[model samples]
Target chain A: MVSLILSTAVRYIFPLQLLFSIFLLLRGHNEPGGGFVGGLVVAAAFSLVALANNVWTAQRTMGVNPRVLIGVGLLAAAVSGLQALIAGQPFMTAAWIARDIPVLGKVGTPLLFDFGVYLVVIGVTLTIIFTLMEE
Target chain B: MMQVNTVMNIWIVLPILIPLLTAVGAVLAWNWRRVQRVLSVIGSAALLGAGLKLLLTVWTDGILALQIGSWPAPFGITLAADLFSAIMVVLAGLLAVTVTLYSLASMDMERESFGYYPILHILLMGVCGAFLSGDIFNLYVWFEVLLIASFVLLTLGGERAQLEGAIKYVTLNLMASALFLAGVGVLYGIAGTLNMADLAVQLAKMEHPEIVTAVSMLFLIAFGIKAAVFPLFFWLPASYHTPPVAVSAIFSGLLTKVGVYALFRVFTLLFVHNIRYTHTMILIIAGFTMVTGVLGAVAQTEFRRLLSFHIVSQIGYLLMGLGLYHPAAMAAAVFFMVHVVLAKSTLFLVSGVVHWLQGTYDLKKLGGLYASAPGLALLFLIPALSLAGIPPLPGFFAKLALVGAGLQLGQYVISAVALAVSILTLFSMIKIWNEAFWKPQPLAATCASAQPVLLIIPIVLLALVILGIGFFAGPLFTLAARAAEQLSDPAGYIQAVLGGA
Candidate 1:
């Protein structure tokens, strides 16, 4: 099922798609782009690689296990919510920083939450894809 | 107010967090069998502890509501616990602890190591979330969470029968979910908010009741299927008996009960404008559900399959209590929920232990438990008798209260039907006793060598709880009556959530 041309094209295309996904995530604070959309884009990037080459190659390229990503992502999202307990807000209250960081812009727990959503989406999407493809 | 709520609300949140964190721990330690197993016990116990505390807090402190992210009512995702929700949380936690312990002996290592424990805990998280959530949309999310987890548990072993059952289970449930989402959308369109409290307030002042009535039907059918009542229960008898007994035990305990919980919650709180039309319809359905369910059980030859039919039958009684709408009846209904959850799950766990020993769930091929294993016979008899509504057991008291309430109102037909169904329930339970335990030992039966004490422990623990409920029926009924009173009037619940609106 592999095509040399598809594989060659995906090598360059995948990184760009990932960068775009991160961009979507960053712009999510006050814009249409957010965790869900950004996560879909990243999943699409990896899926493209899987389509061009194969699942094992894509797995190696991704570096971390999809399930581990889910675990870490959930932990991050939960932590982002619970961090509010320290600030004396209710659980999941969006605590924010008054200053901006480079590339990420003004930081907050919501952004961390978004990032967590991003990773979970990628993990879940790929796991489903990989399982179906293998079957 | 926010400061006070922040401290008070952790009880609401901890039930959910404990499971989520434990599932995370299991996933992170994916290959570490010992850690995952240990986490399962400790996590489930923590949930139980948290639920008990939450129950006490709600009992003494009155109903508690928390607006997540500090958003005001009608806007934020709210978590609230009246007595009803608290009771459900405690039941779920208890089921979790028992089922998790049972899985340690009954479930195979392959299934356990293949992410079973983690998914099971996630299922618990979803159940707790569903119980505590105070918004319609959030309830849907929790429903999906539990749905997804149950789907995995249903198909965990990937057997042919499991896949077949999973298809029916998932397809019907997904269809029901679609209807539920559509109902939520239409409801939000009409009421302009997703919070249940706000909807209640807005809906009470609604001018045209037809649209609301129509929306109410959509919810009724949606939850009806989940509750597996009357004609909507084709999926229950098909899929429930196919899962590993441990999965069946938890699903039997918590899943349908959640559906029943939602039905009563909405009927009491959200859709009280037209009781004559809605409650009467519910009553009719409840009667049919009872008759059809017991009749189905009488025809089943398999142990778990037979019990599965009884699940449908028992659900009819809960709906009957709801339909009656008497305070005493509703209190009896709550007590019935507590009894059934403990008793039914224990029944499934016993079935698992039987299969572990006899190597089959087919009632035809099994016999002689009475002579061979008196302890197991006693364990099975406790729940089976309670389920049949025998005296001195919780089931008997539940039936007496419900029938008493119906007869008091001169609803003679349903009352007669209720008494008749109790007789049939006893008939089938005795049928099982005669066939599987009381009769002579079959020629081909070879009892397994190792009767894992692990399998017996949960059954024994739950059996004691059943007896305890029976012995303490007076206080339990008093508490249930108090809960029923609170449910009958939603004003206090609304006040607790929305503040001095």
Candidate 2:
């Protein structure tokens, strides 16, 4: 019942949006576009896909349960803080190991925590949206 | 014997962390329901251990203060645990474990699958965070976390009755949150600091005392609503009886107490400069809250609803200690809080079991619990009697301490009301006993025979704690006294958190 052109456009747009989200997430620590924003962006893209196609197709694209995504996201964030506990520092005291990745600059616990935040925002948003859409 | 170091700070943070991790873990393994259940219990146990360590560490090392991200005070968020905060955190941990244990048996599988464990742990994380936070803004953040979780838990079943209750609960609490935030914003604007200890020092030096008093009134209304004091308490009984009993038990145990704790903390630490005015208002509110709440309870015929009303009434006693504003009174408040948290939750948990077995919370329909489940009937008596301020019970000591403080302070009218409220409280509790246990069943319907081990364990454990507190009141009173001394002296708190003394 839907137009082929719109679906085709969404297919291309989804991957591009996802890539942009990753860029925003990686750039977050030093820039304005952080995990929360990036995650929201990705969730918005997925929502568009679901709207264009169907929720089932969107779920297939996600491949993992959104609830599990939330759990993993929380773990990642907690681990970033736990690293400080392990190193005999105060809890959540950011400690970094400089490993230069090509475009992302130095990767560190703060970035890791931001990544976790990104996933959590994505998971929570998609979970709520998907449930409401199904209803 | 206590080493004050960065590593020690981890102990201060673990009660919050452990619950967060557990909630995450439970959610991640949602597909495996058994795994989720096991993980939640283990997580709660770990929190209890963490709480014990934190309490012991604070008891030995003085106030244990730590800055998250190693940022110094006035700039970074500090999680500081003095004797009072430590006591609260430990009590939270204890409540968490017992409540979770009760939920394991009493809660339905459908509810558990609806992310119940994750939400419960998050609620505890909020509570521990609220207790440990040294910044007013951080406290607000924690309050939001707990509030959100509570909203989910309260409305999880999607019953028409629950939905109605949830609406009232959420609306009033949201109003409270808004008021609290407004007060925090004004306080921050005036003092230019969010750290509670720092705010205390700055507030003392501020030239505009009138604005400070206005801000204090804002806080009083906000906390008064949350604490369900007097005219502000209509929402509590309206909503609390609607939740699943485990949910009710925790809410009954910790939620309002958190509000009372905030009132005590802010008034004693930051708003002390205007005590004659602010505390006298608190004293007047406390007196009315007691009379109205007990009278409401006397009029209730339902089980959980009666307990809900009692929670409001007991808040009056807790606030009375704060209103008195002396070390003995404050210590009594702390002791009474601990007693209420344990005893009240036990009553709710018992109500859960009765509901489970008898299939109703209405006292009119229920009868002969003593004949049907003698063990549960017995378990109920301990907390019930203890609640009524029977001698040699923890509640007796708790009430005695508060009344003594009131009498000592020569607040005779309030003291008389406190004594009178205890008698009325006993009368209502006896009403429950006579209707639910002593009276013959109106219908000879068969009650369930088997007692779930998971359910009984928490009930028994809580009862034992109430009894323990009653018999061995020495150590607890001393600890509470130390906490009271710290609360009485805000300079000591400020120096410990800000100066690392």
All candidates' lDDT scores?
A: 0.91, 0.91
State the TM-score of candidate 1 restricted to chain B. Answer: 0.99
C-alpha DockQ for predicted model 1: 0.78
The residue pairs that clash in candidate 2, if any, are none
Query: Which portions of model 2 miss their true places by more than 4 Å?
Result: A1-5, B1-4
lDDT of 2 at B161: 86
CA error at residue B147 for candidate 1, angstroms: 0.8
Model 2 fnat? 0.93
Q: Provide the TM-score for each candidate, comma-separated.
A: 0.98, 0.98
**Model 1 C-alpha lDDT per residue in residues B1-501, reported as the tens digit of each score:** 667767777888889999999999999999898899999999999999999999989888889998988888888889989998999999999988899889888888889888999999999999999988899999999999999999999999999999999999999999899999999999999999889988999999999998999999999999999999989999999999998999999999999999999999899999989999999999999999999999999998899999999999999999989998878889999999999999999999999988887889988888988887888899999999999999899999999999999999888999999999999999999988998888876766678856788888889989999999999999889889988988899999899889988
lDDT of 2 at B449: 73
